[model samples]
Each structure stands twice: as C-alpha cells, then as structure tokens.
Target: MEPKININNSTHFSWLSCWPQWTGYAAALWSLLYGLLGLYWFLGGNGFPFGKNDSRAEMMGSFLSNLNVDVGGPVIAIAGLVGTVVAIAMKMTWGSRFHRAIFLSYAWIMSVTLIFIVPDSRIVQNFAYLFLLHFDLLDWRVINQVFCIVGGFIWGASAIAYFRLTQNACGNCGRNDATEGSSAKATAKWGKWFTYFAVIMALPYGIVRWAWALGIPLGTNDSSMVGNEDNVRVEAILGGLCIGGGVLTLGLIQRWGVIFPWWCFFLAGKQIPIWFVMVPAMLMSTIITITGLKLSPQIIFMMVNGSITNENWGQFVPFLFWLPWGISLGIAILAYYLKRRGRCKHCGKL
Candidate 1:
C-alpha cells in the first residue's frame, strides 16, 4: 500500500483541534513562569527554574562571566519579561494575520532564551530519564520541564495549524496578500538569500570539525587536543552531516524543495508538507543557537582574559562558525515559513 498524502487532513489535524486555544493557553502560562524566573534572577537569587548550577548553568555562566554580574541579572530578567509579552500575544491574537508572525517571533526568542534556561533545568532532572521515570513529581523542575516540552510541541503545532488555516481560506494567492501586504515573490527572494548565507556559514564549522577528526589538530594545543580513539571518525561524520544540511538548505529556494527530488525513494516527487521541513529545521536551528549561546561566553573569556594561544583559538574554530550558522539558519527557516504560509501548494478539501 502507498503512503498517504496530507491533503484533506491538513486543516483538521486531530491533535491541533482536540484542544482549541491550547497554544494560546500554553503560551500564556509559560509567560508567567518566565516572568517569575526573570524576577528571581534580577534579584540575584541563586536559583533557576529547576535547580542551581550544573553543566548547563556552567555553560551559560561561561557566557555570562564575560559581562558584569550586575548587568547580567537584569538582562535575564528582561528576557523573561519579553517572553511573557510574546506568549500573551500568541494566545490573544489567534485569528489575526499576525498570529503566525507572533508565533514565529516568539519562537525565535524562545529558541534562544527558553532553550538556554531549560537546558540548565533539564540537565538537573535529565538523570531521571535514565531510570525510565515518568518524572510526575510536582517539583518546580518537573513542572518546568513538562511545560517546556509542551511549549516546544505547541510551536510546531501552531506552525501546522497556521498552514492549514491558510490553505483552507485562500485556495490561491489572491486572498493572501490582501490580508497581509507580504508578497510571495518577496518572501521567496529573501528566503533564497538567507539559505545561501546559511549554507556558507555552516561550511567552516563542518570543515573545522572534520579537520580535527583527521588528527590534524586544526586549532588546539597538544595538551587540550584530547580525543577518543574513534574521535576522528565521529568528528568526520559530524562534519559531513553539517555540510549535508547546508547543501540540503538549497531546497528552500529550488523547486525540489516544494516537491521531493526524484531520488527520494519512497517520497520522490511528492508535494512536501510544510511542517515536514519547517518543524525539524526550526528544532535544529534552535539547538544550534543554544549550543552557540552556551559556549560563546567561554570562547569570549578565553579571548579576553583566559588564553590567547593559537592552539586554544583553533579549538574555537567550529564554535565560532556557530554564530553565523545560527543566525543564517534562523533566517532560512523564517523564509521557508513565509513561502509556505504565503501559498500552500498541496491541501485536499475536507
């Protein structure tokens, strides 16, 4: 039997409709939580959502250390405040043309800020996962993580819902631009440039990693150049994947992006679902952004006061690329989103 296409099912994703305004509710609730956390941080409270410093906190501190502690606290608090407002907007503006735009904007903020805090919280409770634990306990950490996972899922859900709603209302482009002044041509043009930039930025990181894997020690002192026996193999593989993702980004602009390439065995030539591309791309982009933010402080510290050695600088090569990579990837994702939302190519009537 052939796998099905998501035409009729687009508008009425059972999960999305099952709970109307769930996204709104979820966004609002998390907003309040972030507000509280922000207050705590602003007040110099040692505590974060789940617990205190661990690897993730250390990671953030690695960045945080560069700034005056006095400034950092307020910065964090403000991030929370921003999240709160965005979340409220997400819920309050359900039917407006701005709904998805708000969602996307908030998503970018959360991708960096939320992912930053959640990782710290998650690392503390992550061990619970090893025991096959349900983690149903009513502690702040568990509650926070639960909400976080739900929030992440909601981001994807909102994207899907927005696409469906658009497809159903405007069968063609005529009605779309009427409501929102954004044009398909403009969105596509920006998307193409962004994808090119993303691909360009990702190349250096991948190459740097691959170089390390080859035992070339592209950017590190011998003492710091520790690697597992198979480190070379693993790093090489990772580098390839990085380059691969970059190349695949071209699909965002090319026709093959909308319809699967003929080479895709089972999915060949099918009209690709927007969510299929956007959600994962968004997820990866978030992760990349998080990784960069987590490590940026450490990198900065070394350059400023830690160490200025050539080898030490070399180690930072891959991480350095993450800056541009993250920004480019985010833009590319937004572009693809605009393209698809502007005019969905496939959706059967319910």
Candidate 2:
C-alpha cells in the first residue's frame, strides 16, 4: 500500500461549532474573578498586583510604576464588572445593529486593554529567561501579567466566535459559500509586501547584533565593550534568533508553507497542516508586539534622558524598530491566514 498523506488537514478543525457559548461564559467568569480581586485591592488588600505600591515596582516598567494603586484598583474593578456584563451579552447571540456594534467595540477594547496595556516588555523577557532556565527571575508580577494576557486572548477569541455565529458563518473558519470570493486572492496580492516589510524591519536588529558579535561595534566607539565574552554570546544568540525568525517568516508567502519541501525525505511533498503554521505565527506575532510596546516608553525615556548616547547607541537604537516589526509580522500572519483558510466541512461553507 502507498503511504497516505493528509492533504485535507484544513477541514479537521470544522468540529469547532460557531454556536458554542462556553468561551464567552469563560470570559465572563475570568472577568468576575479578576473584578473580585480588584475589589479586594480597593478594600485595602495587602497585595496590590502592580505599581509603585507593589514590592516589585523596580521590575515593573515606568508606565506601570507611575500608576496609583488606589485609582487603578477602582478603575479595574469597574472595568471588570462591565466586561463581565458585556461578555455575557455577547453569548446571547441576538441584538440590534447598534447594540451589536457597541458590544463588539467593548469586547475589542477589553481585549486590547488587558493584552497590551496591562503588560509590558518584561513579560517577553521573562519568557526568554525561562528558555534560558533562569527561573529565579520569574516573579509574581510576570505571572499576573501572563494571567491578564490570557484573559485578553480569551476575550478576543470569544468575541470573534460570537461575531461569526451572529453572521451565519462557519465558527471554525469565519466563512460561508456566499461570502467566499476574491478575498484570499486580494490578501495574497498584499501579503507578500507585508512579509517583505516585516523582514526589512527585523534586519536592522539582526545586523546590529551580528555586528556586535563580530566586534564591529556598529553603533558605538567602545571596542572593548563589544568584544566581551558575555556580550558576544548574548548578541550571537539574539542575532541568530532574529535572522532565523526572519527566515521562518518568509514561509508565510512561500510554497513550502503549504507543502513539505523536497529536502525532507519522508515528509517531502506532504501537505503541511494549517494549524502547524498558524499557531506558532500567531504566538510569535503577539509576543513580539507586546515586547515592543513594553520597550517603547523606556527606550524613549532613555533617549530623552541622555542615558543612550553614542557610546552605546547601537545597543538601544535597533530595538526601536521592534514595534513596527511585530505589527508587520502580525499583518503578514493575517494575510497568510486569509489565504490559507479552507472550506469548513461541518458547515459546508467555503
């Protein structure tokens, strides 16, 4: 018998029905629990999760450090209560156009605030530390941020599923035969451009790190600092990862993204599962964006305070592009998703 290759891998996720309210309910529960935690803090609870009042204020970014816990506690409590109500409403699956618009807006706002506003670059750095097996640097603040981030992703996913259900589309694929047309083709036309832009954005960071590793000191006059063993090792790692990530990013528009290349003996010519590419791309884009956002304020402050001078400009400047790099990568991933998503077998939607 010939070896069987699963080319129809895209249809397997069709089991995910659009009508399920479990995710929405889960979001509501998360909001409720977090709200109660805020209520505790508002009532003079000893463990306020973040800000200067927190014992880990130094590890918290400047933006977080400046936050007044008293004000934040009440605000968070109110937001959580409101989010809980909105999340529950989303599960109802029926509303007027105006009401739907308002609910959708609220859901996205909640997602963005929790994911982007509540956390900073330290969360990404903390994960890198985990990869390095440096568990000592992991702290409660990182855990709290990760929790908030998870809630944000849950809310966002719930909102999307709700939207698809209300629109009479496949919950798993966000499509119907009627809605299918040239959208994927259009995405393909533009996707490559965004991929290129993302690669370009990553280049400066990679180049700087590689140069540092080679003792070129591209951004500064300090030759001695550039050649240090620790500096070289760290820069090499960062540079290699940056370059490798860029290479992987090209697969979004490359042929190999869909099918295994000839280079792999047994896997060659086999269909690559959609989720294999999507899950990692989604995660990478999110992590990159969060890290960039977290670093922006601090980087700007450094530039303003003259803390970043010609003596060490190379170390700090290339990172300034990270925000755009992550954003472009995210856009590229969206394009790839749009291009690759197939007909939903369960709903029979294309």
Cα-based lDDT for every prediction: 0.58, 0.78
TM-score of each: 0.62, 0.87
Q: Across residues 1-350, which tens digit of lDDT does each residue of candidate 2 receive?
A: 21121112353344334224367888899999999888888989876767766555544452567677688889889988998998888877546767878988888888888888888777767766654567886777778888998899888988887777667665666665577665788899789999999988878878887888888878878776577787787777778777888998999999998899999799999989888898888777887787777777777899999999887888778778888989999999999988887665555555
Candidate 1, residues 96-182, lDDT tens digits: the string is 556656665665656444455454323322332324343543355445554554565555444443343444333222233234545
Candidate 1 residue pairs that clash = 63-297, 219-314
Off by over 4 Å in 1: 1-13, 17-20, 28-56, 59-112, 116-181, 223-228, 342-350
Residue 131, model 2: lDDT of: 46
Instruction: Please state every model's RMSD to the true fold in angstroms.
Output: 9.1, 6.3
Q: Cα miss at 205, model 1 (Å)? A: 2.0
Identify the runs in model 2 with alpha carbons over 4 angstroms from their true place: 1-21, 54-62, 221-225, 263-265, 301-307
Using alpha carbons, what is the TM-score of model 1? 0.62
Error of 2 at 150 (Å): 1.1
